[model samples]
Target chain A: MPINSKIVRRIGDLARIDLSITDVDMFSEQLGEIVDLMNQLDGVDTSSVQEMDSEIGNGHENRPKDIVNEGNCIELILKNAPETKEGFFTVKKVIE
Target chain B: MSDLASLTISKARDLLSTGEVSALELTEHYLQRIESSRNLNTFCFTATELALEKAKSCDRLMSSTDRGKLCGIPLAVKDIFCTQSLPTQAASKILEGFVPPYESTVTERLWKENAVLLGKLNMDEFAMGSSNETSVYGPAINPWQDPNEATPLSPGGSSGGSAAAVAADLCLAALGTDTGGSIRQPAAFNGVVGIKPTYGRCSRWGIIAFASSLDQAGPITKTVRDSAILLEIISGHDKKDSTSVRCEVPNFEAALNGDIRGKKIGIPKEYRIDDTPAEIIKLWEIGINQLSDSGAEIVDVSLPHTKYSLPTYYVLAPAEASSNLARYDGVKYGYRATLKDDEGINELYKRTRSEGFGDEVKRRIMVGTYVLSAGFYEAYYQKALKVRSLIKRDFREVFSKGVSAILTPTTPSPAFPLGSKNKKSPVEMYLNDIFTVPANLAGLPAVSIPTGITEKGLPLGLQIIGPAWEEANVLNIAHRLEKDSNFRIKPKQWWTS
Candidate 1:
């Protein structure tokens, strides 16, 4: 495997996600095939190719100030939060 | 009236304007069609009452001088967009009930033109899968069939429901966001018109983020004209999305004169894949001859880096997706797991995310995190970025040859049996977007139009890709091709009694 189970676990931790034992096994196999697919990029000579940092949308990076900057949905945004109190999101306490 | 939903957006526009049909009546008609088409599962949420009410108001407003081309036209919205009253879940459990109080900039623009929202359509979970099978509500079935066999076929994803709805006549048109062919692929599968406008042509403000750099909102409709008109209404400079271009919004519909007298159409040599079915190859030949017959010069082009696009996209998209989707932790919003008495914050994040995201989403996020990790970043992610630039340059080079558009088969095959892809490995399914991904990777405009039917008795689509910010050109060529193909095959009403 280009990537192993331990590495997959490490990735899960970084992504703030959990993988079931079955998913871990399945992903290990699936991602191995996918990684092998990624290795195909090694065959291409991209030495002179400049890495794409931005994107093709609106080739111009410079823009005037934002025309609409209203983020006034504090209440509406909080409506879907799992736990909320006084307009702030709540989570399990970590520090002792 | 049962088939009133089958009317094209342009025709419906004319009908409503002439008072031949009230917007209320039109909305009611589609709402009933939507109810009967439940077996297709095209809609994730139907805004029946709201649609009727909006149609009533639109009817009343028609008494005055204020109106637009889309006034009183009923359209379906992909669940990915955040509509005020409609819960935009993106067909994933994580956002099961995550309704935004505000509307997406694109959908907001729709209402500005008096277009009625019929409901939110279904899609892949977080727009991750090629087959709609990844959706939490189960796969949205392709309405196309072989007439005799009862085997359910898939409407391609991640905009599966949007394509299915448009194909099945559940809505005149729908809003579908494309990242790596989500919009175009499904449109091809369902034999509908779907355009993925040049990146940043339409604002990405309220549409849920997938691969942020690659995701762009466009329209899926029944005809080239409808897609063009919807694209016009939904596209513009939005201060909310800084990436939106300052380029003047052209009269997209008016630009559809179908005059391609001297335009050069590119046929990429690399797109002739070894595994492509002979039927699809024949369709491509037919499309080429038709375009040439319309007085357009046909030129063979080469996109050497085409083979690398899918690999590079898989790497970069998931990497960006991992970063973009990081916001779904338990604290901020979306689905969260119930914390046990002994649970801690770490458990909160993991349990919530594990419970929230589906298998495909989780796989991508893990792969994304893996590629971006310290050691692999140089070997994988950075390399993929360089390769991405090569892929983009390939399109630039071809366009520089004075090629206004490149013609290719939308899907290697027509729509497949719904669960057929499930039996294969994820890599096999990822191969489904082989042709459609290049345009997205280049951030160029592309459209899928129904070309003909396969021997399997299913409809197939052909794709035309254009240079960045050249959607008008792409649509014009598509409009020309639509007339040439004269494809009028509709799916047999097998699902309805």
Candidate 2:
């Protein structure tokens, strides 16, 4: 049940999140407890079960062609951008 | 005046058509009520200018008799949906100032029907908690409260604000999304009818993704008929949402009055949990008895997979949600938490996300990540999904065996007090969705109707779930029960009281 600092750091890395030692320790215990709770699913027999990737799979047969931003209110969408400039959202350089 | 508070869409439409009340007047009435009841926390944000503008347009359309089904009806949208002009924060600080430039398909459809927009109702942050307590704006107060209790009771979450707004007569009805009982639970808590349509019936585009696979936007309304009309307007296919169905969307409003004279209603034996309160059990029995007396056959059906639904939902929903919510990395759309010196972009994302999401959401995200991890994928996430299929198959088998619909209590108990946080253990809190989560897992349509009240006088709801796309059948039975029960239960004490 004790999620040590190391495991927390690994989890933080996996999730692409940075955690302070204090947060790492606190989240470790909390996440550990939640995992312990989720461990209850171990007893459930899912031998014949097929994983549910999507909840509703009935409607894809006649789906329209992938509408890339089709009929979308462009101005409305841009309003969501916190740093849009000239219809493009500006972001810090990732590769540089 | 058509008593703005008690007006149904059908009535409002007829009156509006006859020039009884302008859309502007109806919008103003509700806005005034919202202003007075600001302390109720029923709404997160109100777009008065936008609403007035839209109402004027609706009035202009009415002059030309351009009345669509939801024409002139002012709808209070749940904060979960994105609006172009409004801040679409899911009652969370992470997305505090984030405004979605796009509109959710449901909201867009409402606008197409000339439905006047009222405002956004508050909700639990990211639709995680039951009590709406986790919301950054604070928990919404139930319109009704016990005399002994001075503090506001929880209006049930994630859709607590939507339910409270309708129950308090702030708006005709509102949109709410149900992912693991979000809509139905709050409807039960606030004594309103909430329907979570069969998955894929309504488009999920524009609604903030909670549990992608399980989430469906439905109407939380005062009457089953109102919910049906709202469903008719909102339920349809959109090219925007890949998951939307191409099947013929039924005329739900016309089907509302259909005869349920001899339908077979299944009583899932597993729904009667041992921990359910005696009063709730009694209420369930009364509902069953009422259905039976009305010429519906009550058959004991076994959904053997029922017990596994909550756990399956917990695993599956979090797994999907963790993936869906990965888009909100501060830089793209939402709030960015500035990292300390020496920290880079990765650290900023980590800090922002960790700080942004609340405990329950974080816990789910972690579980989701853990389950979807390479080593654990096959064992956990994949395994839970398989159980999910079996659960859906169980409902199909029951409905196939001459059962038109399944009946059960929405929650194990009535609304707990707002701060009754420590009363139930986490597992117990998870069990609150035991009855409702199965319908979502199966992608079947279901509704929660206020069938009865507990001995202590809090409202208890009975959920009626039907096979996929059988929304009409479910609403018919619910309407029949609504009339038969005649519970006439209102909030115990209004805000003024």
Q: Pick the candidate with the highest TM-score.
A: 1
**Candidate 2 Cα outliers beyond 4 Å, as residue runs:** A1-5, A20-33, A55-59, A67-96, B423-425
lDDT per residue for candidate 2 within B1-497, as digits (tens), equals: 65787787778878888999998999999888899888898888998999999888888888675667777788898889988768889998889788776688898888888898899999988888788888888889888676566766889988999999998889999999999999999999888999999888999999889888889999999999899989988888877888888779888878877478789999988987888899888888999999888889899999998887877887788888888888878766777786566666776677778888876676667768877888778766777888888888888889889899999999988887777765224455676777889998988899999988776678889999998889999999999899888867677435642
Candidate 1: where is the Cα deviation over 4 Å? A56-58, A64-73, B1-3, B422-424
Give the number of the best model, judged by DockQ. 1
Give the fraction of native contacts in model 1.
Answer: 0.81
What would you estimate as the lDDT of candidate 2? 0.83
Worst 10 residues of 2 chain B by lDDT: B421-430
Model 2 TM-score on a 0 to 1 scale? 0.94
Highest lDDT model number: 1
| Chain A fold similarity by TM-score, each prediction | 0.80, 0.66
